[model samples]
Target: MPSEPAPPSSSLAERVARLEARQEIEELKYRYLRACDHKDPEAFRACFIREGADIDYGELGTFATVDDLVTLFERIALARHNEGHLVLDMHHGVHPEITFLSSTEATGRWTLRFRQLNLAEETERVLCGDYDDRYVVEDGAWRLAKHHFRSLWSLTRPLPKGYVVDEGAHL
Candidate 1:
């Protein structure tokens, strides 16, 4: 017999602030993926807080500070680089669900499609996982407060010899 009242509209300023926060977080995620793929430890480290950061890459070991991750990345990625072996990787993130818990805190979930080609091992690995992340404002900028990834499935295969992908092939 009666209808509920419609919800009030958010103010223009509030809406803009929310959008800005989301955009900042999206950029942070993008930078992280790019840094990882390019093996740029400095860029990767910049995406997170320097102190009191929790990074659990799931079997890669957890680190309390961003410096720890950078150290590991350099040890692993640099060693491969120095040996003249290629380690190409790509990280595609989709289906982002970011929630702003407060002006200074937020949480996010994302689906990650990761591909890696290890020339030294002559193998390629494809992985799919979800990233659960936390963000906080430190020094008036949004930074990754905590980051974790849980793999859903993965595949490792040897690349066929003399295999070449034709760039001209199209639908």
Candidate 2:
């Protein structure tokens, strides 16, 4: 029987392609944050694996798949709809320090800030946090594999009397 053929080594062109793609992923990460602040699911969805991904929220532990994340968001969005608690409601920001782990993987730490009004609690909150994320290149796209969110600080207080929520405050 003939011996099996040897596998081809990674060519220079292949390496260059991988590097270029990784850089593109980094750019996508920044776009993702802005898109999220805009509350555009179409944009947000582009940043994640959308299936078989894991998310860890520290004390809340980890969710095994992207579907879980979607489910939670659905609940939040639905509740917010009734109370007009839409995010992108206030100034929200994410600053990323993304690093390449390999041609197909990377990790990043992000600083995040957002405001939320919890009508059920009759309180408004400003949350500041850091997110540690793992990214994977799958099928030529970068997707979040494990996302860990930790709140570093939070300020909560009552909404001022006669203070009306404005959806365009940040826009």
Q: Which candidate leads the pack in TM-score? A: 1
Per-model C-alpha lDDT, please?
0.81, 0.66
Q: Which stretches of candidate 2 lie over 4 Å from their true place?
A: 1-23, 59-61, 80-95, 168-171
* Model 1 C-alpha lDDT per residue in residues 1-171, reported as the tens digit of each score: 001222268676766687788888988999999888777888888899869987899978888778988998877665544435356778999988888787788899999999977776878999999999999998888999999999999999998998543222220
Tell me the alpha-carbon RMSD of every candidate.
6.2, 8.3
Model 2 per-residue lDDT at 38? 63
Runs of candidate 1 exceeding 4 Å displacement: 1-9, 81-85, 163-171
Could you tell me how far off, in angstroms, the CA of residue 13 lies in candidate 1 after the best superposition? Answer: 0.5
How does each model score on TM-score? 0.86, 0.70
Candidate 2 colliding pairs, count: 0
